[model samples]
Target: MVTKTIEVVNAQGIHMRPAGMLVAEMKKFPNCNVTLKCGEKTAKATAVMQIMASGIKCGSKVEITAEGENEQAALDKAAELFETGFGE
Candidate 1:
């Protein structure tokens, strides 16, 4: 398992488009268990609605976790996506 920390940088946060993108990326790794969290709220990264509902405002700190054989790569990719501002 691996967990990486990042801050939301997209001006609009993780809105619908970015949330869908994140979910789609997450779904590519079936053996992984992914989780996204902001402060005390956490949800499965596989769920678009749950991620959007996080209300993770810009600059909010977030934790991305992945557990599986490919945990490190999964976490790294997620961190890269967030660090890139979700392609904003």
Candidate 2:
């Protein structure tokens, strides 16, 4: 498993558009399991609704975990997305 903690830099946080983008990207790693943790909330990276429901905000710190096949690649991609603020 691989993990990285990053801050949510997008002004809108992980809204519908970014959530959808995350889901789409994470889905590419079918063999890997991606999870996001923020405060007391935990969500599957590929679940848009769960991600939005986590209440992630601009300054929120998120812990991303990727396990199983291609875990590093999955983690790297997720980290990149967060670092880029989902291209907001």
Candidate 3:
């Protein structure tokens, strides 16, 4: 598994649009399993509802984990998105 932690930078946090975008991007890596962890909450990265429900706010630190084939790539992509504030 590949793992990385990033602080959300988007002003609005992981709302509908960003959650949808994250799910869309994660769906591309069929061979990998991606998950997000924030405090005591955890959610599947491919589930938009779960992501938004996690209440990950701006400046919140989230740990991303990707396992299986293409794990590294998947983690990298997630990190890029988080670092870029989901292109807000």
Candidate 4:
């Protein structure tokens, strides 16, 4: 498993749109299992509502984790998205 911590840089934080985008990305890799956590909340990466519920505002640190055959790639992609603020 791999985990990377990053901060959200978008002004909107983790509203529905960005959350959906992140879920879509997470869903693209079936070979890997990905999860996210912020503060006291933990959720599967593809769980849109759970992710949104994390209340990960701009600058909030989030941890993205991945495991399985494609863990490294999955973690890299997820980290990229978070680091880019989901391409705000």
Candidate 5:
């Protein structure tokens, strides 16, 4: 298992558009389960609704985890998205 932390730099945070994108990306890594946590709230990265429901605003602290064969790649990619601020 590997974990990464990134700040939500997007002005709107992980809204529907980005949430959908993130979930879509996560779905590609079937061997790993991606988990996202914002502050005290955590949600499965595969669930778009749950991620959106987390209400992670701009500058929120996000932690992501990937566990499995490609955990490292998964975590790195997920962190990249966060660094992009979900493309906001």
Candidate 6:
């Protein structure tokens, strides 16, 4: 397993829109299993509702973890999304 810490750079955080986008991206990596944690909340990366429910606002610390065949790539991509503010 591998993990990366990133901040939510978007002003609105991971609302429904970005949650949907993130979940979509996560779903593409079938060989990798990923999860996201913010504060006391943790959610499977493939679950849009759970991700949005994480209540990760701007500047919030997010821990992303991935394991399996594509763990490295998956973690890297997920971290990039957080760094980019989910494309704002």
State the TM-score for model 1. 0.95
lDDT of 1 at 22: 85
Residue 46 of candidate 6: its Cα lDDT? 96
Tens digit of per-residue lDDT, candidate 6, span 56-87: 89889999999998899889889888888777
Flag regions of model 1 displaced more than 4 Å.
none
lDDT of 4 by residue, 1-88 (tens): 8888988898988888888988898888987889988999998898998988888898888898899878998899888887877777
**Candidate 3 lDDT tens digits, 1-88:** 8899999999988999999999999999998999999999999999989999999999999999999999999999999999999888
The residue pairs that clash in candidate 2, if any, are none
Collision count for each candidate, in order: 0, 0, 0, 0, 0, 0
What pairs collide in candidate 1?
Answer: none
lDDT of 2 by residue, 23-85 (tens): 999999999999999999999999989999998999999999999999999999999999998
Q: Where is the poorest 10-residue window by lDDT in model 6?
A: 79-88
The better candidate by TM-score, 2 or 4, is 2
Model 5 lDDT tens row, 12-76:
87889889989999989988999998888999999989999999998888889899879998899
TM-score of each: 0.95, 0.97, 0.97, 0.93, 0.95, 0.95
| Per-residue lDDT of candidate 1, residues 1-88 (tens digit) | 7898999999988898888888888888889999998988897889988888888889899999999868888788888889998888
CA RMSD of all predictions: 0.8, 0.6, 0.5, 1.0, 0.9, 0.8
TM-score of candidate 6 versus the correct structure, residues matched by position:
0.95
Instruction: Please give the lDDT score for candidate 4.
Output: 0.87
Name every residue pair that clashes in candidate 3: none
Lowest-lDDT window of 10 residues in candidate 2? 12-21
> Regarding lDDT, does 1 or 6 come out ahead?
6
